[model samples]
Target: MTKDEVRAKWAVAKRMVEITEDEYASHNVEAQAIKFVKTKLQIAIYYLSQLDEHGSSYTMPFTGKQMKEALKTPITKQNVKDAADWCHQCRLIRDKACATWNYEEAKTA
Candidate 1:
């Protein structure tokens, strides 16, 4: 995805809070905090993922519970893995569009 798309996703993800007064407010705060860190995380990973032509082994910081809370996905190990994997894919695509093709044009070959 483009940087703007990633940013928009992050914003939308942030606003998708399912918290209520009757529900666990502490859980809500913790989940939101995790989301904040994850957002910061995507920006960093996106910058670095571009450094590689393919991708990198970027581990997500959030635990299974946190990942489930933020993504609203199943609490499987692969689900958490896919979250990071998807970010890496976006990063590689974003970087290659700018870095790889332009460098090839400038190459001696």
Candidate 2:
């Protein structure tokens, strides 16, 4: 996913929750959702980092993988894929091109 796409998705998601620039400044409900998305993306990126550290060919049990391991329930590839897709849908990550965080564009009015 590209960065721009992620930002776009975030914009849409924020709108869906009726979050505006003013609310974000005040740290209101919409801001909370933004925070959730940011945290989720951060965790996903950390998971990707762990995968990189472990090497691409290495396949640990889903239960052993740091990201999956942290989950209370079993984490499947489909689960990660779904979350990743959600991030893309929320414009949190780009589905194509480069991945980036469009904080300025997404947060600004």
Candidate 3:
């Protein structure tokens, strides 16, 4: 997603988080449903973070030949292990976006 789109999704997720928290606090039932929704929202947030605004996925830190080889290989545990650093970078970017949004909201509040 674009930066703007990411920010918008983060805002929506924040609102949904608040709503789900309130729902859990106010009701005596359906806790599982609320938790499930929150989980899905979080997954969406992270998945989107791995894509650029143009919707192309970010690549791992590899040479062109390595990237091609990796693509040809089936996804395995080793692939995820190798991509940990890239994943961490993406998570940091996502967190920064969310933090900037929260800071802006805090200023207004």
lDDT per residue (tens digit) for residues 61-101 in model 2: 22224333333234345445544554444332222212232
Cα misplacement distance, residue 81 of candidate 2 (Å): 12
RMSD of 3: 11.8
Error of 3 at 19 (Å): 6.0
Clashing pairs counted in every model: 0, 11, 2
66 Cα displacement, candidate 3 (Å): 39
Q: Judged by TM-score relative to the true structure, which candidate is superior, 1 or 3?
A: 1
Clashing pairs in 3: 1-53, 2-53
Model 3 CA lDDT for position 1: 54
Deviating ranges (above 4 Å) for candidate 1: 1-10, 17-70, 100-109
Please report how far candidate 3 places residue 78 from its true position, in Å: 34
How would the candidate models be sorted by TM-score, starting from the highest? 1, 3, 2
How many clashing residue pairs are found in candidate 1? 0
Tell me the tens digit of each residue's lDDT in model 3 across 1-109.
5567767756754454343446557554345444444443444445444344434444433343432332233434444443444445556555554454545543432
Give me the candidate number with maximum TM-score: 1
Off by over 4 Å in 2: 1-25, 57-109
Using all chains and alpha carbons, the TM-scores for the candidates as numbered come to 0.35, 0.31, 0.33
> How much lDDT does each candidate structure score?
0.46, 0.39, 0.45
Lowest lDDT sum, 10 consecutive residues, model 1, at: 49-58
